[model samples]
Target: MINCDQTLSISNGKMKVAIEGCCHNQLEEIYKTLEHIENGENIKIDLLLICGDFETIRNTEDFNSMSVPAKYRTLGSFYKYYTGECKVPYPTLFVGGNHEVMSYLWELYYGGWVCENIYFLGYAGVVNFGGLRIGGLSGIYNDRHYDLGHHETLPYNTSTVRSAYHMRKYDAFKLAQIKQPLDIFLSHDWPRKITNFGKLDDLLHIKPYLRQDIESGKLGSAACEELLFKLKPRYWFAAHHHVKFPAIVYHDERTSSIYQSEEMNSKTIKNPDEINIDIDEDLENPDEINIDSTTSQPHISEDERRDQIPCTKFLALDKCLPGREFLQILDFPEANGQLEFSYDEEWLAITKATHEFLNLSFNAVSLPRESVIQSKIDPELRWIRENISQKAVGLVIPHNFQPTAPAYGEQQTFILQKPFKNPQTEAFTRLLNMSNKINPDGQSRPQE
Candidate 1:
C-alpha cells in the first residue's frame, strides 16, 4: 500500500514541483528524468504535479466495461508503467485530463473504484501547501452533453456538469465574493487565451481534440475563464496540448488599434483581454444545448444498482513502485527570487513559503520564472491595478511568469507608484486591512 500522507504530502514549507503530461504509458520519460536528476543533481522533489492525461486510453469507460483487456489497454497500461517502471516518489498530484476526467467522474459517482496513493482532485478541488492554497479545475471536455446512465437528466456535459458539481464554481464564485484571496491555481486546461505557443497543439493534440469534442461551447469554460480574469492567481501550471516546450500567457496591457474597416472587425477574433470577465460564455441555453446526455451509458454494459450507481472494479498492484521523488527549493535570500533545487528541510520551508506566495500571484504576475521579479513592489502594485484596482491596461504582459525580456535577468526589488485616489484604491486598502484583521495569526485564509 502506498503511504498517502508521507508519500504525497502538502503543507507549508514543502517543495513546489512541476511535471508535464504523462498520458497512458509515457512512464519511461519520468523514470529517465528522475534518474537524470538523481545522478546529475542532488535535488529532492516534493510534489509531482502530473497535469492531466495520466490514463493510458484516450477515451473509454473504465467503470462498467466488462472487457478487462480493453480497459487495461489504456489505464491498465498507465498503471503498469507507473508501478513497473517509474516508482514515482514524493506526493503525486493529478488533475483529471480530458481522457481521465470522464472515467474519473464515473468512478467518483460509482463507489467501488479506488486510486491508491495518488491524490485525485475530482475535476476541481483545492490543496493546501502549508500556507498556500492551490486550487484547480480539471474538468475540460468538449461534449457539453455526453451520456451517463441513470435517467436523471443533467444540464451540461460531464466536464461542465462536473465543473459545477465539483468545487470550481464555488471556487470562482467565492474568489469574487470574498474579501480575502487564494494563493495558487492548478488548471489542466489553460484559459482560452492564455498561451503564446501553439506548440502544445502538436505536442499534446489531445487538448485541441478535446476542445473539438465540445460542441462549439465558445472555445473554453466560461466559469474557468471568469475565475482567471477575476481572481488572477499568482502562478498557474497546465499541460493539455503536448507542445515540445511550455508557453506562458500573460495579460495584455496594450490599447487595441481602432479598426477602420467593418470587415476586419468581424473577422478579427476579439482579443481575450476585452471579454475575460464574462462567465456567460460558458453556460449554454438549456433549450439550445441538450444536457440529458447518454454517451457514457451506451458504453456501459453492467446493470444499474438499487442506488442507481454504476458498478466499478478496483485494481490492486503488488509492491507498487511509486515514481522517484525530488524537492523544489526556493532561495528566498537570493537575488530576484533565485530558484534552485535542494532537499534540505530548512530550505524546503523557505522555498515552500515563497512558492505559496508566488502561486497566490500567478495570475497577477506576468513574467516567466519567479527569478525575473525585478520589483516586488511594482508587481504588487500592478496586481492591485489589474485585479484589485480595475485599471485599464496600457501594456499587457503575456505569459504570467515569463518576462518579456529574458536577458534582463532577475530584479531585486520593485517600485510601486501611488496611484491617483480612486474608489478602487480605497477598496484595495479596505481589502488589505481586512486581510490583516482576519489574519491576526498570520495564517493564510481562504477567500470566503
Candidate 2:
C-alpha cells in the first residue's frame, strides 16, 4: 500500500493504526510482510501508512539514465504486482521522502510516470483512513534550512547532508502547516530529543551522528519538534532513526500552546506542564523498561492487536486477471541478460506511463526495430494495435533467418510496428525502407 486510511472499529475498543517506515524500493517485500502481519492479527487493519523514501536513487542523473527495460522490470513489476494483484486490508497512505520527491523531479525533467495508488505527497500531506486522521512529512528533513544553511555546497550535496539536515528542515516546515489534530504522524526521521543527538561511537550504543547535531543544537526535525510543541499528536511513527533509541517527551495542553518565548538573560525552553524523557526504549516492544505507557501516558494495548474488518476490494478485470497467474518470461535481445521470473503489473504500467505521463515523447525517439517483446507480445499490446490501431512500437520481434551469414542477394528483415521517427506516422516504414528489405509474402517475424 502506498498510503491509505480506513476506519476499523475493533471489539477490543482500541483504534488500531498500522504505519510502515521508509520502504526505499522494496515494495514486494513490504507487501508480503504486511500480508503476513494481517493474517496473524486476525483483524483487518484500519489504515496503512507509509513514510517516504519509497524509491531508491542516489542522484538525478542515475534516475534519469535508467534503461527503459530496467525501469519496467524493477519498479514496473512491483507496481503491477502489488497494486494490481495483492490483497491489502486497509486504506493505504503514501508520503514522499527524498527519494519520491527526487523521482518526481526527474519526471519533470526526464519524463517518467509515478504510480497512481502510490501517492506522492510532495513535502507533506494529510489523509483520512480507517477513522484516523493521518498526516505526513516526506522527503529529507530541513531541506529548506539546509538550503539556507549550506549555500556554499551549492552544486553537489551528499546524501548525509540532504537526508539528515535539509530534508529534515523541509519536513519541519510542512509540519507547521498542518492545522488539524492528527491521530497519527508518519515521519521519516525522529523528533527532537536529548537522546536523538548523541555521539557516533557504535560501541557507545549511541546515535553519534544525531548527537553531533544536538550538540550543535541541530538534532531532530525542528518542524516536527515545533509541531509537537503545537499540536502534540497522539502517535508519531518515525523511521529515519533506524538504530532504536526511543525517547518520549510528555506534553500537556499548556506545553502544546507555547510555541516559543524569551525569558531571563539567555533563553529558557520550558517543558510541557508535565514532561519526562527516557532513552533507549522501544515504545512498540513490551520488554524495553525505561518508559511505560501507564504513567500519565497514552493508553496502549497489551498486544499489538488489530481487528479484522470487512474491506472493499476494487478490481479491474480488463487490465488484470484476479487469482489467475499472469506470468511472462521477458527476453532482451540487445543485452546479455537472462530472463527471470518476477511479479507486479502496476510496475509495468508505471514504467510505460512514465514514458507518456511525464511527456517524454518529445525527447525520446524509438524506431520499429527497437520494439521489445514484452510490450508487443502481451495481450494488452495486441489489443491496442488491433482495436485502437495506435501505431507505435510497443514490443520488439526478431526477423526470421540468420542475419550474420545471409546468402548472396538474399535480404533479412525484422518486423516492426512503432510510430515513425519523423512526422509521418507509419508502422513498419523503417523496415520497408531498409536497403535489404525482404519480401513480405515470403518472410515472417519469429513466432513467440
Candidate 3:
C-alpha cells in the first residue's frame, strides 16, 4: 500500500526551509552549506532544522557527559554562539541525539531555548512556525530504557550518560495525544521498516551491515512508525542512520482515525525477567516493551492532500561530512500574517493535563491512569484557553535567554559548574502556572 510522491501543500509566498542531518558539532560547515544553498538556489531559507547529534557543550565538564570517545570530542561552534562570540545566520531548530550533552537537555525537559535563534524540541514536543506545525522527539529509541523515567542526573557515569538520551515511552505517549495536523515531523531515528518504501538498493549499497537487521524486521523505531501513521504529517524528516534516504508512508484510511482516548497506551510488557533489571545501568538487547502509540490523527481535507496521495513524505539525511548528503532544502507555504515561533495550543494543553505524570527519580514512572487523564484534559484545555491563549503575551514562546555556563574557551581557570535551572524553562513553566520540576528549590549558578 506504500508509494512515493513529492508535492505536499502550497500557497502564495514560499517558505524555503533547510533540513540538515547529524550536526556532529559542525556548526561552521553547516553555516557554509546553508550559505551555498541560498546562493546556488537563489532563495532565502526561513528556518534550519537539524535532526540531532548537536553537541551543545558549554565547557569541558559538559564534554565529559557525551557518549563518544574522548579523542572525537571537541567544543564545537555551539559555544561561540553561546558566548556571543558569533551569531547564528538562521533560526535553527533541533532535537537531541545520543551524542549530545544529556545533562543540559534534561534541564529543559519540557522544551526551551538552548541558545539564541536555536531551539531544542525537548524530549518530545510540537511548535508552530510560519504556518507549519513542527513536532519532534529528541533522542534515539532504545528498547532497554524505553519504559523507564528520567532517572539520570548531572555528573553522569559511563552507563547513565549513554542511556540518558534514549527515547522514553512517557514522552512518546504524550506526543500521541495530539489531534491536529503537523506540517512537518522530525525524529532522530527513522521509523521501522521504512526502507520498504524507499530506495532500498542504494541504502544496502552504503550500509551493507544494516541488511541483516533490515531483513530481520528490526531496523528502526516502532514508536516513530506508529506516530508516522497516526499523525500523518505532510512531511517527516529524520537523521542518525547517516544515510540520505527518502521514504513515503502511505496511511490507510482506517489509520487516519484519531486516538482521542487513553486506552491505546495499555500494552502488556513482554518479559517479566527484564522488569527486575538494574534501573541505572541498562542491560544490552533487553526484552521489548511496546507503547501502543496513540496519535491525534490529523484529518487532511481534500484540498490539503496534494495530488490526492494521502502519504507522509519521509526523508532521512546523512551526518555532516565532506561529500555526504547531509543537507536538504524544501518549500513550505508562507505564513498568512507573520513568520515567528509560536507554541501549539493543543500541545500545551497536553503538557498541562499530563504534567502531574512527570517522573524525575530512579524509580520507574507509571503512566497516568487512562481514566484519570481522560477526565483532566477538558479542565486543562479550559484553563489554557482562559490563562494562556487569552493572555496579553499569548502563546508566543518568549525570548528570555541567559548564559548559565562558562563560555566555551574563556581564559578563566577550569571550574566545573553543575547544572542549574535554565531561565527559559523557568519562564515557560511559570507562564503555565506549573511548578518548576527541574530545579524545585529555584537554585542557580553565578554567571561566569
Best by TM-score: 3
Cα lDDT, all candidates: 0.33, 0.34, 0.74
Q: Identify the runs in model 3 with alpha carbons over 4 angstroms from their true place.
A: 1-4, 7-13, 253-309, 334-337, 369-372, 411-417
lDDT tens per residue, model 1, 216-256: 44444566556665555544455554432222222233212
In Å, residue 15's CA in model 2 sits off its true spot by 4.8
List, residue by residue over 61-171, the lDDT tens digit for candidate 3.
787678999899888888888877888889888999889988678778888788787888889999988878899998888888888888887678899888898888888
Q: Number of the top candidate by lDDT? A: 3
Alpha-carbon lDDT of model 3:
0.74
For candidate 1, the per-residue lDDT at 289 reads 29
Ordering by lDDT: 3, 2, 1
Ranking by TM-score: 3, 2, 1
Q: Please write out the lDDT profile of model 2 over residues 1-448, one tens digit for every residue.
A: 1111111112233344444555556555455544544454454434445665555332222333222233432442333322335433334455554444242222211111133234333344444433445565654455344333212111223542243223433224334534456555666655554232222243135445555675675655556656655655644555554332223333433322121111101111011221111212221222222226558865543221111211111100000122211111111112221121111122222222222212111122222221342343354434434533333532221111121111112222322221112111112223222221112222222332
Candidate 1 lDDT:
0.33
lDDT preference between candidates 1 and 3, better one: 3
Positional deviation of residue 28's Cα in model 2 after best superposition, in angstroms: 1.7
How much RMSD separates candidate 3 from the native structure? 12.2
